[model samples]
Target: MKIVTGRMASALRLACMASTVVLLAGCTRYGQHGYARYRTNCGICHHGGEGMKGEIPPISGRVDRIAATTEGKQYLMHVLLNGLNGPLDIDGVHYNFSMPPFRTHLSDEEIASILSYLATRGDTQPVPVFSAADVAAERAHPMTTSMVAEERRRLDALHPLP
Candidate 1:
């Protein structure tokens, strides 16, 4: 067997260190923007994305799947802008509550960042990124919370959960 020289060993160690740094950075790519926003605005209701079981539907595991579809993406945008009311079922659990509107408190960019953070953080599958432009476009239409709830029903009919 060939033995590595001191120079070669040093180079290998440096390479390993560099690789580790890159891997760590990659793990933290979804930094504070979205998480901070979620904590401040959404965590009150969502409880850090874990929700309150039957009372509040957990968004962490569900959002990525909802964000996968065009209508579902729009639904998320509308829900953020307009809020949501009435009964909703997620993964066989029911949540009937009023989600207050954030349009007055958050900017389009902030909302998009929050959505992006939810979509990416701790998720293994690929999910579509929400841009500021998407939020702005939804903002232009200005649907009421009731309208948003109705749209959610329509979307559920169109794409029933399996």
Candidate 2:
């Protein structure tokens, strides 16, 4: 007959409890599809939309406003598909970091979901939701990062940022 020891039993119980906690934590953190994708992809630099001061532009409230306009919406799609380079001024703060393109890594659906997720954050009014079709359209006509930047400049001239 095998004897069960108290120390071994306690250690096993602790290990099981630790694993359960970890699994639950993961489920809680990645509860939504968009949130999970955003966490894995955009969270590294944007910090879940909390963005670094004067570095990464915070996409929370600001994105929703930008997305409110037609030109801004197309600009957003181009930026995501082609990435953005050079200096960007958001709400009077300057950010010069190069945003990497995610078109290669993420599907149209995923990009739309991430953009939708961003729209919900820090937004007080209703914002246009990005659809997979929108992303696909942008994907069909690929642009260089510099071109994306130029498009943004044109959009800014037309719509202006708030």
Candidate 3:
């Protein structure tokens, strides 16, 4: 009876271990789906150390400054959907690159995943959840020079830069 009891206990332990392994694998698969999508699409330019002549920005840890601000986050979503041109300032350096709009190509969820992946890359922290509603709002009320100024003004009211 004792030998049979020991064998059953061992078998139960093995089954538990197997179950844990399968559960972990499923979680990894779920996370990797988004990662894979980013690698296939955005990684082409962002990961290529030296970006296209004047097309893509290095989207690795280089986006830290922009990701740290409310205005910047909104601007990023705007740029992702609407694209950008003219004198652009990111991380204090100016890039006169013009990004063709990807609004039609990428859904809001995909764009959010791409941004989340970019933010979590390297030592950077993950960005806040970017909802489809937020993207729609930005699209409905596009950012103009005045809007940028207004956002800055709001930030100033809170922090009051010296």
Candidate 4:
């Protein structure tokens, strides 16, 4: 009876582990979808895969570092909403490429997915899902002074003014 009980316990443990793995897998799938959305929308400038250079920063993994910060996250969202074509210092390298606004091209959910993918792929952090309300808010108000300050400070630190 004891041996049978032990076997049952082991089976239960295995089942629990399997379920947990499945759940984590689902979350990963969601992140991947978000990544795909980002690639479709922002990959032109950000470059999802290797090979491209000089024109824009490789946003796949490097962006997570910037997204980890509060201001960095907001800056990413703002950039998606209101694209910037100024000096960008990514991974200590200066990239002065123009990132045309994708506001009209992608909906807010799409933008959120891209940002979420960037944050997740770049770092171990789990970013909040972008919602329809988030899109509406950004479109209605856009970024304010404080958000801009945070972005500039972080970017300046990465790539000082020449």
Candidate 5:
């Protein structure tokens, strides 16, 4: 997906940020803080975490399972910071592509917001809430894509993802 940046991007989310009061009062706090950003930034490729054609790795209903464990949660954070390249076998589908890193462009809170939005998408299941502090802690030490892939391997050995 082509990630847009600069003045144009800000204009898109300006409306959402401005309406935070209305959203928070009527809906979940998670959606208001992260909705617009997720739509423009993440929704482009992940499509509200539903993914596409098995190549994007849906986060909608499955991310809660991955974020349940501490290690799994870290893996998710690192994937955002370090990005993920190569192939992943999810269920019966083969997902192979490069998930670009947002470490530089996206802030700690932004990453947390998006991840938190994803984590809470599941209905009736309790999910870990990603905070800015959590993202900051993980950001202290960064990893490479290969390292992240290895972490995924380790996490997957214990918990298989969707």
Candidate 6:
């Protein structure tokens, strides 16, 4: 085999760098939008998905466990679109707060991206990625925050997630 030297080696290295840059950009495309949105819209309150001492529910490393199922995914959409209120239990901690709905400001795609990012966050095992269509399906049927909470109760009662 002939060895690559001088100009040939330089050209090869440049090509490799270009390819690596493209690959990395593509790799992060799925989560980048969600990350930015999450930071702006969610991180402050949720504290980078860690929550604030059981006062808020976290997204990273938690909750996405349920996103593994279809009904659970639907419940998540409802919660985002309609908000969640009253007392809730997560990982043995109790949180009582009002999570405002983002239906007006966040689009279906944005909501999907946020959830997909959370579900596939580095700290948690990746669940199914959400599609804009999925968010749209839930957006079609609007519900009150209390209604969403009731739905959450029904879902958790039927099938709990750890």
Q: On lDDT, who's better, 4 or 6?
A: 6
**Once model 3 is optimally superposed onto the true structure by TM-score, how far is the C-alpha of residue 76 displaced, in angstroms?**
0.7
* Residue ranges of candidate 3 with Cα displaced over 4 Å: 1-33, 48-55, 88-94, 122-127, 142-162
lDDT of 6 by residue, 1-162 (tens): 245567788899999999988756533344788877888888889987888766887667554677877888899889889998998888888889889999998999899888887776634454568889999999999999999989888888998754
Candidate RMSDs in Å, in order, are 6.9, 6.9, 9.8, 8.7, 9.9, 7.0
Model 6 lDDT at residue 13: 93
| lDDT, model 2, position 126 | 57
Number of colliding residue pairs in each model:
0, 0, 0, 0, 0, 0
Q: What residue runs in model 1 are displaced by over 4 Å at the alpha carbon?
A: 1-30, 122-124
lDDT by residue for model 4 over 1-162, one digit each (tens)? 999999999999999999988756645434766767766766655565341566666765655666655555556677777766555555567666656666778887777777665556544456544555666676775654455545666765875321
How accurate locally is residue 86 in candidate 6, as Cα lDDT from 0 to 100?
93
Lowest summed lDDT window (length 10), candidate 3: 25-34
Q: Pick the candidate with the highest lDDT.
A: 1
* Sequence-dependent TM-score of model 1: 0.79
Instruction: Please give, for residues 1-162, the per-residue lDDT of candidate 3 as tens digits.
Output: 999999999999999999988755533222355466677766666554335434555665644445566766686677677665554444455556555566778777676666655555435354444556666677676554444545545654764411
> Model 2 over residues 1-162: C-alpha lDDT tens digits?
134587788889999999988755533221366688889998999996879989888886777788887777788888888899988888788989899998799999888877776776645365468889989988999888999988888888877775
Residue pairs with backbone atoms closer than 3 Å in model 4 (clashes): none
- How far off is residue 32 in model 2, in Å? 1.5
Write down the TM-score for model 3: 0.56
Model 6 misplacement above 4 A? 1-28, 122-126
Q: After superposition, how far is residue 84 of candidate 1 from its true place, in Å?
A: 0.2
- In order, the Cα lDDT scores of the candidates are 0.81, 0.80, 0.58, 0.63, 0.79, 0.81
TM-score of each model, in listed order: 0.79, 0.77, 0.56, 0.63, 0.79, 0.78
What's the ranking of the predictions by TM-score, best on top? Answer: 5, 1, 6, 2, 4, 3
Alpha carbon lDDT of residue 130, candidate 4? 54
Candidate number with the higher TM-score (2 or 4) = 2
Output the worst ten-in-a-row residue range by lDDT, candidate 6: 22-31
